[model samples]
Target: MTTESDVAYAHQPGGLLKGKVAVITGVGAAGTIGAVTAAIFVQEGARVLAADISGAQKETALSLGPAAAPFQVDITREEDVEAMFAHAVETFGRVDILVNVAGNPGGRRGPEVTVEEFESLTSVHLLGTLLTNKHAVRVMAPAGGGAIVNFSSAASFNIDERISMAYSAAKSGVNSLTKSVAVLHGAQGIRANAVAPGFTLSKKNHRVPPEAMKELGGKAALGRPGQPEEQAHVAAFLTSDRASFVTGVVVPVDGGWSARLA
Candidate 1:
């Protein structure tokens, strides 16, 4: 469970995520938020299982060392979610953290939106969140405790001209789901929180032109796009001991964009 590298990145000599076991979905190629977060977790003494629907998962896992494992799981499927949690328990003995990052852009226009568009986004963002937390809590409650961090989007709170209607609604639902889990499960020693990220560039969603990107960054008080590591740090903190009393909170890792609008 422990590895040589996991000891190095701790905030303290024995850092926050030490001895923890985390399963992060949507870990893609290097330079991604999920990839950076997984490395940070392992470096801080957590055994990490990085799951992605992509075939690149094996390559991503190999670089993180023996303490890190990768599983190809489709968050849209209940069986895949079940198998993912099972794989974590099988590999590391138990699950300490569950981070839900598997989401898609519901790209249809509002007038053209189909039931499928709504369902696709809901399946990944809403149902996926429910399935992962359900199985994770099942194990965590009996075993004493655990933490979960689900990804919501700042678009849910702030109207984005770029993202579609379904994407916004789906993320808004995730925010609601986060609170429900936390409210229902807190006494059982299960803590659930959410991270609402601003427009951070990803391989798939970085479609904005350079001029627009600059304009968007300037809209934030920080006047810049958020780095993936910035969000990773927040994710790491929410799952850490320092956040022991934190649950049902949706922390915006938005570079103050939400407040800028205010």
Candidate 2:
């Protein structure tokens, strides 16, 4: 697999994010969007603070380099989210970007789904994102401004086919938050945007049978699902100065899956 380092970036400078400080959430496991984004930011010369609810985040952040630090945080908890931002400021001096990528995957609801199940999904995806973004906005306001790149999903716009109703609703909430932040904070120098991905190749989805991957790709207009790096590339651009004029938009990195015929 050709890495980002191997490919020379032509759109902006070679290191688009040099001297920037970034805080990325939802990096519990390796190869996830959060983990991948953290690595990409590091590679692009940005210091990263990777946080997650799980402890595995330490290993993931450590793998990146000294500039990457890991913290255990639950975005649903305000204290934890606050601490995450404070930790970033204390360690990196200041924060310039935030990638709200922390979320759960097991949103499949059964006929007898409990309230706890519904709340669990909502709190993790929607509420958690709000909390993190809220703090990021507060911390960034006094610092002039910053960039916030959120993770949405194609499920927010159409049927998930996977039938994660709670997840879809939560992600839709995320889209709203993204736009709201962009509109309200652009005057303050903050650029907020989202990336909606469909069937990306991640640690979770890679477990699906190979034939299933092929089937998923066949459903998309691009004849393929997606790669984590492909999605991360878009994220990097959104958070970088190259996207200085882009805000309040949810760009789909789903290989046209969002545009397929129903």
lDDT assessment of candidate 2: 0.86
Maximum-lDDT candidate: 2
Candidate 2 segments exceeding 4 Å error: 1-12, 109-113
- Give me the displacement of residue 229 in model 2, in angstroms: 0.6
Report the lDDT tens digits of candidate 1 across residue range 137-228.
88788887788999898888867766788889888889998999999998888889999988786655466788988987776778888877
Tens digits of per-residue lDDT, candidate 2, 1-262, equal 1124423442556787888899999887788878988888899999999999889899999898898999999999999999999999999999899999888865455455567777998898888888999999999988988899999988888885565777788889999999999999888889899999888888888788988789887767889878888888898888887777789999988888889777
Per-model TM-score versus the true fold: 0.91, 0.92
Error of 2 at 201 (Å): 0.9
Clashes of each: 0, 0
Quote the positional error of residue 245 for candidate 2 in Å: 0.9
